[model samples]
Target: MDRTPANDTWFQGKAARSIHEDQLKKVELFNGRAAMIGFVIGVITEGLTGQGILHQIGLGPLVDGYATCSVQMLPFCF
Candidate 1:
């Protein structure tokens, strides 16, 4: 006896080419990786600038302030 699909609505003989296939995840995975790298760079630049401004204005803990700013971007990275 042979087992096969009863309908073609979903399968369409292309099940092997579906996005659900692990290999199809490469595009999305690459995009996510690129976005993560860009986000980290943006966070670092922005935080450093803020810290520089604060220090020039005689504020204390400028480095801590910058570090705190960078922390806020962590959740948004992913």
Candidate 2:
């Protein structure tokens, strides 16, 4: 293959495509890591603030209902 300017131009397109693909992969990786880190921070903050899971999701009554059902089912389990 002759090292001509035309050949260089042809290779440039392929190089640009590979560079673009690498950049996109990097962006995706960064976004995924950022989301995971943010989630961990949020969970840690919530825990430090002393907010229980039921209270956090406004499902306090649901837990009470579950407790009641468990009590009712205790006899059946035996």
| TM-score for each of the candidates | 0.38, 0.53
Stretches of candidate 1 above 4 Å error? 1-12, 15-23, 51-78
Residue 45 CA error for candidate 1 (Å)? 0.5
Candidate 1 lDDT trough over 10 residues, lowest sum: 1-10
Candidate 1 residues 38-71, lDDT tens each? 7777677658775444454476475565557656
Write model 2 residue lDDT over 1-78, tens digit each, in one string: 799999999899999999999999999999999999977876886789776556567886766666676665865542
- Give the residue spans of candidate 2 off by over 4 A: 2-6, 50-78
**lDDT by candidate, in order shown:** 0.64, 0.80
Candidate 2 total steric clashes: 0
Error of 2 at 17 (Å): 0.7
Instruction: Supply the global lDDT for candidate 1.
Output: 0.64
Candidate 2 differs from the real structure by a C-alpha RMSD in angstroms, to one decimal, of 6.3
